[model samples]
Structures are given as C-alpha cells and as structure tokens.
Target: MILIRGKWRTASVGFLCTLLLLVFLATPVWSLVSRSGDQIIIGANEVIADDLYVAGRTITINGTVNGDLVAVGRLITINGTVQGDLLAAAQAVVVNGTINDDLRVVSQVTQLGSNARVGDDAVAAGMSFESLAESTVAGDLAFTGWQALLAGNVGRNVTGSMAALELRSNVGGNVNVITGAEGDAPEAYPPFFPQPPVPIPQLRAGLTVADSVQISGNLTYRSPGVATISQQAQIAGGVLREELPEDETAAPAPVTTIAQQLQYFIALVLVGWLLFKFVPNWIQSLAAIASSKPLPSLGWGIVTFLAVGIIAIAIAFVTFVLTALSAITLPVLIFPVLGLGTLANLTLIFGFLLFVMFVPQIVVSLLGGRWLIHKLQPSTSSNRFVSLAIGLLIFVLLTAIPVLGGLLHLITIFLGLGALWIWIRNNRDRAPTEPQLAAV
Candidate 1:
C-alpha cells in the first residue's frame, strides 16, 4: 500500500506539472491584484490609480477609482464614482454613484438609488432589485431576481427575469420580461359599463406584469399565460407576448427530508472510506496536527491561503505583460512566463477548492472516526470502516442544526484547511534527498 501510494502521488504531481505547462502555452494571462481583509473601506478623499480588487466583511467605497472596481463582501455600499467598470458580490449592495463603464453585481438584495448612474450596461442578479426614480442607466439594464421594481429611466433596454415586476418609469428602448401571470382586470363587469372590461390574463404556473407602465420601444414577454395591455399604458412600438413552452416551464423544487440527510451521510462515508484506503498516513498526520496545535495550524493556513492568492495575481499580471510582448515581438519568451503563471494560478485556485470542499470532508471524517473509535472501545484500534460510518452520520446530523450548524461548518473548514497545510509542509520536509553524482 505504501509503495502504491508513493507511485500514485508521484504520477499525480508529474501530471499536474505537464497540465500547467500546456495551459501556459495555450492561454493568455491578465493583470490583477487582489486585496482582502475585514471591514475594508476606501474614503471619499482616496483615489486608486489602477484597478482595485477587494474582499471583506463590509466594503465601503466612497472614493474615486481610476480603473475597474471588483469587490466581495457581506455588505457593500459604493457612494463614489468609478471611472471604469464595477463588479461586486455581496449579501446586500447599494450603488449610489456613477460607473463610467459597465456595472455588474450579485447579491441577496441590490439597490440603485436616485444618485446612481451607469454610463454603460448594468447587469445584476439578486433576490430583489430596486431602481429608484432618480437613477439612470446610459446603456442596457438586465437583471434576474424574485422581484424587480424599476422606478427609474433606462437609456437603452430593460430586460429581466422575475417573479414580480413593477415598472413605474420609462424604458427608452425595448422591454423584455419573463415573470408570473397576474393582471388587475376582473372576470366580469357590471351592467352599468358599456362592455365587460377585458379579464386580466392568468397563467397556469407563470409570470405577470402590472398594468401601469410606459415604454418607448417594443414590449416582449414570455410566460405560461399572456398579459393584458391596459389602454392607459403607452408602448411606442408593438407588444409581443409569447406563451411559455410546456417543456420550458420550471419544475417545483425537491424537499429535503430525514431520508435525504441519511443518503448524504452514506455518500460521505463512502468517500471517507476511499480516502482512508488511498492516503491513510496523510489523513492521520493532518488529524494529529489539528488535534494538537489547532491555533498555530489555523494561523498558518490563513497565511498560506492569502499569500498564495496575492502571489498568483502578481504572477499573472507579469505573465500577461511578458506574453503580450512575446506575441508582439519575441514569441519564444512567452513559454517561461506562461509556465510560471499557470503554476501560480493553479495553486491558488486548487488551494481554494481544498479549503471549501475537500479539506472539510477529510477533517470531519477523521475527527469523527477517531471519536467513534474512542467511544466504542478504549482502544484507538478499531474497524476503520465502521468508525468512518459513525463519524459521518454524526457530522451530517450536526450540520442540520439551524444556527449552530453554520458556525460549526465554518470552524470545520478552517480546521481542515489548517491541518491539511501542516501535513503538506511536513511531507515536503521529509522528502528523500537525491544523491549527487560523483565529481568527474
């Protein structure tokens, strides 16, 4: 087993190296520097000469950014101007400033206040979107959300996928909406009326648009049912409402019950069993590190994780310049830069993947298995498969807890990543040295 594991590890490393070399030869790199910390804020008086990338718990940008702005946080508020594009992801986002170029955002809730203006396209995805009356977009506006309320003006086009929509403003161009089926008109009218008011259209399982809206260009909508065009509504062009295809209608979401949880536990056990079979020593080492020096391991893990990202960004930026130069003049020089950039990028990305996905699984399994063994018998020597199964079951159950579960999940990820890093460093230190050739 030891020999087999060594051979596999060697082969995997070689394959990774070869793969990175190939990527370096084929792909082009771009320049970027990523900055991350907790509660990062750029004051109004501050200015960024080049592109700015930031990740934090709360990000507030009240300064002028000469280049593009990229940010991720729990809460993000941009009150200053961006000379270039802006990309943001957060739990809640409020943009009250101007974006010289495009604006892209993903969040639970997004608001574009009256002071907000986009020089180019505005694209957003969130649970809810609110566009204040004073807000304006110079180019196209596209959004996907559960509810979209646009009380502002769009210069080019307005496109959205929503469950509920309210447009109390003007769309300079076309209006395209995919939503539920609901209308204001009743089924019948009283005899006092000249004629029965048209019954508002209703969809089987679809989307609806409110009756009060003003659009300059054509109106296009697709839903299971059609929309009722209010005579009061002003559409400069024509209206096109298409029935949603039967096959294209969304299906109901599946419910996760106790049975589902049990299945998840079983799946995790199988994966853990495989890990134990192939890399038992590595798993044992990580478990030991996590149990003994948790704090130091966590500190090192955080450092490694952040340092790798910063290094990768630097490498990629340099590689881009070198590659561009090679593309323009000396093509031969591109290879070295490409190879180095590929290695850096892959390391950063793969490390993130481990922290988020693999490390948690491995660490949780190891801890659980060890605990289960201790419980069943005072002996640490027990059936590995049975211990793993018990541990995974307990882990799954704990994860189902409401608030505590989330906190536990985070702790597990941190511990797992830390332990994994320590184990890797230890292995590197213990690697066998190659003998030097005798002097000629």
Candidate 2:
C-alpha cells in the first residue's frame, strides 16, 4: 500500500511539473515571442513533437515539427516537415515537407516542394504558386490566384482563380476552376447550377490546362472569361465545360475546399502583416503583452468565432427565405422587383459572410497585442503570466467538475468576438473625409 501511494505521489508531482512547463511555454519567452514594443525572431531548426506556435516576427521553420503550427507574423517560411496543420501569415511562404493534417498558408508567393505530402487539404492564398508535381498531397488542393503550376499529386479536387493555371499530376477528385479567359474568355456554362457567378466575359490573357485532364469526379467551372487548357491533361470525370459564344475553349482551374482553407489562412496572414506594417513597434509591443494573458485571450477568441458564425448563418437563412419568395411567391409579372429584393438580400448575406470570415483575424491580432502587454507590463495586482498559467491549470483540472469544458468553450467565442470588435473599432476611419458632402 505504501509503495502504491509513493508511486501515485511521484506521478502527481511529475504531472504537475509538466503542466507548469506548458504554462511557462505559453508565455512570450522560450515558446513564441511577440511583443508590442520589441522585435523578436524565431529561427527554429526543427521540432521533434507536435507543436503550436504564435509569434510576431519572421518565423522561419527549418526543422521538423510534429504538431499544429499557428503563427501570426510579418513573414513565415516552413522548410521542414509538420505532422499537423501549418497555419501562418507573412509576405511570402514556401512549404517543403510532409504535413499530416491540413496546410493553410497565406502569402504573396506560396511554393510547395516536390517532396511535400499532406494528409488532407492544402489551401494556399497567394498571387503565384509553384506547386511541384513531385509533391504528394493525399487531399484536396485549393488556390486563389491566376498563376498556379501544379506539378504534383492531389488526392482530391482542385479549385482556383487565376490567369495562368497549369496541371500536370494525378488528382483523386473533381476540379472547379474560374478565371479570366485567355482569348475571348472561355465559353459560359449551360444553366445548370442555382445561378452563375458572372455573365459571359473575356479572358484578360492567361494560359490554362483545361484539356486532356482526368477527373475522378464531376467538374464545375464558373468563369465569364476564356481558359485554354493544355493538351496533356486527362480528366477522368466527364468534363463539364463552360464557354461564351465569342470565347475560346476554356482551360481548367484548381480545386475548392482546400483552397478555401488556404484563403482563410492567407487572409489571417495578410491582416496581421498589414497591422504590423502600419505599426511595427505597436505590434511588437502587443506580442509582448499578449503572452501574459494567452489563456484569457484564447478563451475570448473562441466566443467571438461562435457568435459570428451563428449570426452569419442566421443572415444566410434570411437571405435564402427572400430568395425563395422571389423564386416562388412573386408573380412572373413582378419578377423585376422580386429579383431586386433577391439581390439586396444576397448583398446583405455577402456582407455578413465577409464579417464572419475576417472576424478571427481581428480578434487574434488584439489578443496577441493584449497578451504582449500583459507579459511586458505585468499588472501590479498579479503577474499576468503567472495568473494566466494558474487559471489555465484550474480550467484544465476543472474538466472533472462537469460541464466546465462546455461552458468554457462557449465563453471563449464571446471573448474572441469582443477582441475582434475592439480591433475593427480601433481602425475605424479617423482620416479627414473629403467632406460628408453629397448623398448619392
């Protein structure tokens, strides 16, 4: 009995120490360094285990990390393997390795290496993507650029918006491409889906590989412009081609979900980078402060996301209702007004979508900032970092309390929204208006 008791005591102590270490790491010190007043640099060679990152500088990963990577920085480059999701922001990003989960990166130029392998989706938001065919990603591939060269393997679909899009690899899913036409803009799609994104339009000059493509699933193209596919592609699924009367044969584009994820990440990076650009010193300070209250900030962030998501969904439902009214209730004689109302509802829905989409970016930036201040300033009432660490420990242990986790989860989203609200309100126009002169 004594022996068992001794073992239990030792284990508890060990666990406590480990917990302490994690909390310590949560600070701005050894783990992630970002401050509102100082510049920090993270040049990691590699990580042996799963990792989560949050920073405010040029974060360059040249080593292996076996965990999720979440970073907000001026620049981030991952030249190593990540066993989980790779989330980052910067002016440029180059990923060359194996990512077990999803890869969400936003930068001006995102390059995937030939040896890169992703278990799930690979989303990239960039102006240009040089995707090596040698890269093996066992999931979907998505992009939002007019310039993408796919020379790799995609397990799922491919979606993109580009001027010059190329594909030279095996894909496991369908492909959805939309871009400006090459010649007179590719042909328009026959009315099939709910509604087309745009009317027939011309390509502004770009190369595309829509021909000779093999798709395992159905293809969906939404472009008003021309896309000239390369002759070396083989689409397994029946090609659902789109064309305008005056356009050339449409070239294919990239996939979807993965690309959407990438866009999400890219937007994060851009918004963060933009913040830093306008206030480098302030950003550095924010990072420094943020580390002091990571748990609190993180908790809040969760709340904001939930709130926004719910609100957005509600807006979408309302829009859908209006659309239904216009489509069904409105008489054919009053089609124009119905159409007008539908458009208005859609516009409102879109605005809400944008709000939900960018909400995280705004919240995180402020969280990062506040955390930075807490760490650097350390409130007199308590060492914010220490208090935060204790609070986190309490929160974790309270899981046995029942319903705590659920409550915490809900509370987190609200906090996030609060921070985001602050961020947006802070950036509200203070500039001299030409004049609040004439109403349109």
Candidate 3:
C-alpha cells in the first residue's frame, strides 16, 4: 500500500507538467507572441497535412490546410481552403478561400471575398464586416461590430448588433439586427403629388434594407430607432421590431482620468503596506539581488519570458489536437480532459496577468525603497513609511510620462522580473540534496 501511494504521488507530479504546458499555450502567448517582419506564409502550391497554428506580425495562407488553421497576428489573409475550422484574430482578416467548416474571426476589419464559401456558421466581430455579393454562406451569419455590409446569399439566418447595416441579400431564415444611434432620418423632398415628408427623430443606429433584399423568414430587430426599407423589399414572413428602452441599453465607460489615477495611488499604498508587513525579507532580498546583478537579471528576465511563451504554444497545440482525438475515440475521457484544459487556460491567463500587473510594481518599488534608505542613511528611529512612500511616488511619476515613460516602465519590468528569477534560481540550487538510501 505504501509503495502504491508513492507511485500515485509520482504520477500526479507528472500530470502537473502537462497542466503547465497547456497553461503556457493558452492566451497569455500575447506577450512576446508577435514580432514585426516575421511573417509565416503558405505558398500557393504548398499543402499542410495536419493542423497549423501560427503567431506572427503578418500571416498569409495561400495553399491548403488539410486540418484546422488557428492564427493570431497583425494581418491575416487566407486565400486557400481550410478543410476544417478557421479561427483567426488579427488587425485585419481577409478570407478569399473556402472553409469546409466554421469560420470564426476577431479583427479590426473582416472581409469575405466574393468567391469565399463557408460550409458552416460564419461568426465575426470587428470594426466592419463585409460579405461581398458573390460570397455564399451555407449557415447563419452572426456578428457584432460597428458596421455590417451584406451583399451575399445567406443559406440561413442573418443576425447582428451593429451601428450601421446595409443589407442587399437573400436570407433563407430569420433576419435579426440591433442597430446603433448614428443614423439620420430621410430628408424631405418636394413630391409632384404634394405629399410632405413627416418629421422623424434621429436614430442612434440605423437599419437600411435595399430593394434587392428578400427575406423568406420573419425579420426581427431591437433598436432605439426605426429601419428604412425600400418599397421593393420583399419579406414573406413580415417584420417584428422591439424598441430598445433607453435605460436598458448601456453606453461604453469613459477613458481613464485623474480621479482614477488618484484612486489607484491610494489602493497601491494600502496593498504595499500589507505586503510590507508580511513579506519584508523576501522583498528586500529580491531588490538586493536585482541591484547587484542588473545585467544578469535582465538576461534571465528575457529568457524566462520567452521560455514560458514557447511552452504555452506547444501545450495549446498538443491540447487541441489531443482533445479532438479524444472526442472521437475516447468519448468517456472527454470530461476530465475538458476540465484539465479549462484549468490550464485559467492558469495561463491568471499567471500572465499576475506578472504583468503586480510583479513589476512590487520589485521596482522595493528597489526604490532600498535606494532611498541607502541614500539617506536613516537612523533606527526613522519611519519605514518614508522609504515606501518615496519608492511608490517615483514609480508612479515614471509611469505618467508620455513616450519615455513607457520605456522606463518596460525597463522596470525587466529589472524586477530578472531579479526575482535569479533569486529563485539561486535558492533552488542551494536546497539540500535528498539522502541516498543504504542497503539493509
């Protein structure tokens, strides 16, 4: 029983490694993920046998992906066929290919070329979504964006929440829209028949259906303003519009202001005080190591940053592929796998955020505190608040600077991270070695 317990414990430790890899591959790869001029391109004649996952500044796929294609970059263009799902996030997404399955995208601008065909649902959110007249979607078109211009044929429903909509298409199913508040009422023109145009209120969001539109199913919409439908617009099932209440619809929050900065200062001071009270020694040690080995610390910081990122990508690729396989061959194990995958994703997100937000601040402040104490050569009777306050103030000021302040912020991050990494590594090396067993 004792031997069996030991084996199980060892297995658990091994399982933890898998979790780390999965976490690494998760979303936090955004840090050190993309590099300018490092574009990944699939040539026009090439073909990929398996799944392709890529991250860079610009990515273009002109060949064929036999499996799913997942990409994150500044510019993404797919001009070939993806035999499986297409998942992409970028500044610009242009699809001129055929997607055998679902097409999902998040970007500043998304364009589905006239020749593009999506076998399944086409989901996208961006500043603008344009489906040209020649495009054909075999499934629903669901979108949330600033503007949606549809001139294509949708096999099923067309649904979107947008600021502006231009529909010149045929929908086989329902048409649902939530328009924004930036549309003007149609202008009055003198008609020879002598019927004056009635006055109407300005719409925050406007919906326009051209004469070319044909909806076989019910047309539903929720908007603060009314839609403008051309006389020739055909709707077999009629239209249903629910007016959105002013109170129920919320606007975006304002940008950061001085009040928010002051609040942040107060919160930082309180948090620093708590950290000081409980972990003074650890903080001091990190600062001391950082100050003494500045270059080494910075180097280690870069290394650690990259190592975590690479590990994460590997994990994500492995997890996705394995999950797909398990869903097919070992359905019974899917739940446990999904649970682990979720945990891995959370770990990556939280860990990245922790380092990005807290570690740098703590390390830099601690260094500033140490520097202040040394410069003043204060007596034993001196208050610790003076040093803490000075450190926090310096950091805050540096962060406030325009362009140069951004550089300082980055430096401070490296200094702190490098110092922490060095300290941890040294301590681990200094730990006592396990005792060797002697034969009985």
**Candidate with maximal lDDT:** 3
Tens-digit lDDT string for candidate 3 (289-356)? 66556678778878877777887777777777778889999988777777787678779867875765
Candidate maximizing TM-score: 3
Residue lDDT tens for model 1, 236-274? 998888776534433211133345777877767766667
Q: Number of clashing pairs, model 1?
A: 7
Each candidate: what lDDT? 0.64, 0.51, 0.65
Summarize candidate 2's per-residue lDDT along 277-379 as a digit string, tens digits: 5754443333333334445555656665666567666765765676667667664535565466567656756765564444333433344333434554454
The true-versus-predicted C-alpha distance at residue 130 of model 2, in Å, is 2.2
RMSD of each: 20.3, 18.2, 21.1
Q: In model 3, what is the error at residue 424, expressed in angstroms?
A: 22
TM for candidate 3 is 0.49
> Which of the two, 1 or 2, has more lDDT?
1
Better of 1 and 2 by TM-score: 1
